[model samples]
Target: MHLEETETMHRKITDGVYYVGVDDHHTALFENLWPLPFGVSYNSYLVVDDKIAVIDTVKNIFTQEWLDNIREIVDPEKIDYIVLNHMEPDHTGALPKIAELAKNATIVFTQKAAGMEESFYNVGLKTKVVEDLEELSLGKKTLKFVHVQFVHWPETMATYLAEDEVLFSCDAFGSFGALNGKHFDDEIDMRMIESESKRYLSTIITSYFKFVQRAIEKVKGLGVGIKFIAPSHGPIYRKDPTWVIDHFDKWSSPELDKHVTIIFGSMYGYNLRLAHTLKKELVELGVEVKIHNISYSTMDNVITDAVRAGVIVLGTPTYDAFPFPKIWAFVNEMEGKRFQKRPIALFGTHGWGGGGVRKLKKYLEENKFEILEPNVRCRATPTEEERQAIKTLAKNIAEIVK
Candidate 1:
């Protein structure tokens, strides 16, 4: 590997590879669902050899910026192959523009992505469908494709540069944060990256966790040394690539942390008081607890904590004879994500009617969550007996987690 002074615009990965990705700071939400408090990045790579190849393209909105980044390295028309690792718009929205400019470039992707290419852009240009473990020689550099289906999408695959030992993992190891000129993992605050990565995993890829585990095992089975992991989002893992890999393995595994997450929707502070009381009991019992008010907290954060915790507790005030709207919405979201089953405790308050706790209990049980004993329900405020029941509920949860 050779070192060169970093250019003001693009940074070099090694002698021939370059980072041509773009940062997105304007989009307030990721996929129009998850909040983007730290923004996000769309990473693309350019491999310069005897035959130049562009790994991926950024979102259409950042076409000019992406083009300018590549133009600084080589003429767009000189690109020999445009590798489509994933068909998601965030990574392929600029494909049509690049294909138009690079008239001679042939689109290279897996057999599955070939059909998606036409559906997405229909550029009608030349294309090459490669098989898994197939290698494409670009003079001095050799690129190998590994099929890792359903890392989040069935058509997803990762490219490996044997010479440089860099894995161009599309979304398999991605996070939700912009590089902001800090492209390497060691250059930024990793604590923030780990948290955001967990949130990303829970929101985007948790449903396909089994696939994630298989992908990780397959990549490891390849027995290739990985010098860097360049994903389509967030920073490149150069310092400790295994850190991200191991974290993904653990997050996808069915193991839970010894902690509790309490999510509540309180109307007029009745259920809110119950949530606090439960928290106090759990804390005095030496069990860690995370409390979230669904009314204001984003679903992304709540899900992140919920996925990590060993025990889950819900408190909602009855609304229209059902669980509170926000709490009900959260439960639906968790159901879609298909989180690992854990012990759950339910508590709620009602005025004239009392069906909220019952409905919640049934739904949670149907979803495979083990219901803890003493499912507490009360009137507008908790009575002395209900308070005792809440404490008992907390004790049972702590015992299970411990």
Candidate 2:
């Protein structure tokens, strides 16, 4: 692995393709909402084929570094193509600079993504519009375009290298973590990959649940013979390309895990007790459980935990005749996820009347959840009867989740 003066590392992905991406540890947030505590990588690829095509561009903040990396493998001026699989800013930030260096390179992207790219940068680079299953030949390698719409963005697409059996997935199957000099999944420890991938999907791809499934099916149906997956983020899957796709298929499906996520908000600690009680019951019933206090935890983390659960438990304390403000906001955000039909249990404490539980129940029903029978609600503290009801609620949830 030879490095340039700027420490530019251009790794050979295959005989013809090279990894020319850079890690972004300075960006505090992804999309300005999801936290990037572990940092992320803005991946780009260099396809050294007949005409020297660059797969994608990096962020503008690393323009010089990116250009240096490109210069390491091939003359920037010799590059003839710049492919845009998605129109997202992170992937297109260096377009203007790159176009300047690779002066004669033609910008290539889907017909649908062309408008967005033009509107995004308005750089007058000669362009080539490709369609789904469209083939672009670069001497020895044949690049096939697979249109995967709404995998997160409206015009998002993926590029497949036919000869190499490598799928350069733009954002699909991407995780939010820097590569730390490693170029392939086979080279990195995968203990954290699953969680980070789940976090990325839950935060970025979950909203497009049906679209995700459709895109996966559309690509799989093509039978392009994928053996490597080079997503725009995270480690490239070389040993097993379908590895991330298989994970995406299961995540997007209707099937839920035999696990429960309990989210609770408490002002006087009574609501938290109910959450713990429910967790204990679920654990005793041989069900996996994770409890989180929404007040301190970010929504991204909570969403990741909730994505595959067989059951969801929402606990809150009544405040001003309604559910706690934070909990209500979190639950309201979750309301948009109407595709999930998992069993739900609402248990909370109200000081005077049962306003919190009533409002939460309405919200859950509005979101089209299959609410578990016998919800637990108590005034101030749990009475003997209320405790018995809580037990019943837990038992009913166990039956449905386990």
Q: Local distance difference test, per candidate?
A: 0.90, 0.85
Q: How close is candidate 1 to the true structure, as a TM-score?
A: 0.96
Clashing pairs in 2: none
Per-residue error at 168 for model 1, in Å? Answer: 0.7
Error of 1 at 242 (Å): 1.1
Clashes of each: 0, 0
Q: In candidate 1, where is summed lDDT lowest over 10 consecutive residues? A: 1-10
Candidate 2 C-alpha lDDT tens digits along 128-210: 99988899999999888888998768888899999998889888989988887876888877777887888898888887888
User: Model 1, range 1-402, lDDT digits (tens) per residue?
Assistant: 212323225778889999999889889998899999999999999999999999989899999998888989999999999999989999999999998899988999888898999888999879999898899999999999998899768988999999999999989889998888888999999998999899898888978889999999999999999999999998899999999999999988887889899999997999998899999999999999999999999999998888878988999888999999999998898788887888889999999867899999999998888999999999977788888898889889989888
**Native-referenced Cα lDDT, model 2:** 0.85
Name the runs in model 2 displaced over 4 angstroms: 2-7, 337-339
